[model samples]
Target: MKLIVTCLFSVIMVYSTIAQNVAISDDGTYTADNSAMLDVKSTSKGLLIPRLNSFEKDNIPLPAHGLLIYQTDGEEGFYYNNGTPSAPEWITFTDESNALWRKDPNKNVTYLSGNSDSIGIGTDSPSARLSTDGMIEAMSDGYKFPDGSVQATAVFPANFSGYESAADRRWVIAMCADEIPGSWEYQGFEECSKVIDLEWGIYVPYEPGGGGVTGNRVHKPITVIKNIDKATVRYIQELVEGQGINEIEFHFFWINPDTQQKQVYYVITIGDVKVIDFNHDVTHVGNEIFSHVDIISFAYEIIHWNWLPDGIEFQDNAIGP
Candidate 1:
């Protein structure tokens, strides 16, 4: 009885060891446990395999469509297509009209679009998917200006007095006296002492009365002196005949005292008469004559005769005297 019991006990121990080395599911099929299995092949009864976690080719069951499964607790789950599983946290589906679907924080989706096959993470287009390093690639294409051009206008400061007519009032002068050599000298005069007279006057407009005496002064024609750095004369010459510049004219006007009639005279100052080809050019000449007349002194005077009443007042009506 002792010998039979010893043999039975030995056999029981061996069976127990084998049972500990293998794993059995509820289906009655066995698989290798955590140990004692390496490079074993599958059989009809079971698979003599390594541990399920250690086996490189183990068939992992994928989750159903639209379903998610997790490998470890607290980790995001992945989706499955057919029997094949994807990386953890893979996208399954997203709402088409939702902007949050396009701006997902985790960035799990691969392709993105408004369709069902697309999974948006940060953008509505498929090209906006995140790179491998979890960085969102910029998909903004450069844009051009709408009309392909830029426009600007030249502006001058308000304090600039170069174009103001009121600032030119100081140029008007009646007469300037200058001392000259004198032929005869006093008793104590030095040798070669002489005296002469020099006078300069500016042209000014005056109304002629019935007595021939001018009255009711109107416009003043004064010589404008400009000290334009080193290129003063050269600059003035260029402006006189440059592109788009036609003939320049100096205008003189006289108004009658009694009838207030006015008469105007024009003299060609620079450029040719043929240069006035267009009406626009003529208008430009008018502007230039009003603004840019500088240098060169002119002389004029008025002769008066008492033919009308001294205190008479007249209303302006006539076109010319």
Candidate 2:
């Protein structure tokens, strides 16, 4: 109480006597600068500001606008209230408007320091040098495994650039086609019987003209043959244009409901030649070919709609040497 009274008395006396800018200094030669309201000059010592935690800082009664304070807890930094005394908004001095990488207060796990430190993503207590509890996606520069094995984002053979294999083609086809739930047979062509048996392939009826018989009602299969054909043709074009050798051996068959006979279609590229051999002998139609590209085309447009490119047999049977 005595100390407070003495300090208040001293301030009153100093205000009464000094009409000019106030200067607090130990040296006799030091004088107050014209621009400054109060300047405290020190050589060895430093001026100590009021330090408070986030809770204590908030509790400060009627905090004036532009009130400077040093926050000692949470994201520790010098803070200044930019808002009015009625509604104060404390802003950190370190937060730059133009900074690319800024501290996010909402995220509690990110830890940064001056020294060599471990970075933890989605985790506070990191175990390794760089630990992450979530999936680490590598976009451009591919990441490495714990065993030091590198996994690139895109992997392609040196000779076959942008050349997707039969498996990739099948995957694309499967992805584009309508998915049959559970087993492959639910209202689709998977339950259909194979019409013909080749050395390395089996021709399955994708669309048997109309729907197949199931119990009382006839379940119609989703006609994805056209989509499958377009995808297959596009894949073939890509393979041929990329100068990659095609090793695809697949059959698409259309069954006639009248005679129970099947019209077969063979699609495979040996070197650069895209072969779509249509078995017209079953229909007694002559073998007529169309200009597929400048290189290859098909004449039997009716059979093109019946193609169902599925379960491709990846055989080493190349037509040319």
RMSD of each: 28.8, 21.1
Tens-digit lDDT track of model 1 for 1-321 = 999988875552123225456433333334556567432333434542222221222244543444333222233233223333453223423423534245555876543545345444544555323312122223563222364222211111223332211321211111111121112222222111111111223233544574453644342222333221222343344445543223222322222322223333212132221111111112225332223222433222221112132433233211113
Alpha carbon deviation, residue 78, candidate 2 (Å): 1.8
lDDT of each residue in 216-260, candidate 2, tens digit only: 322121111111122344434443554332222223433332222
TM for every model, in the order presented, reads: 0.15, 0.32
Model 1 gets an lDDT of 0.29
Q: Which regions of candidate 2 deviate over 4 angstroms?
A: 1-19, 95-98, 103-321
Q: What is the lDDT of candidate 2?
A: 0.42
**Positional deviation of residue 219's Cα in model 1 after best superposition, in angstroms:** 18
Best by TM-score: 2
Model 2 scores worst on lDDT over the 10 consecutive residues at 170-179
lDDT of 2 at 292: 21
Q: Give candidate 2's TM-score.
A: 0.32
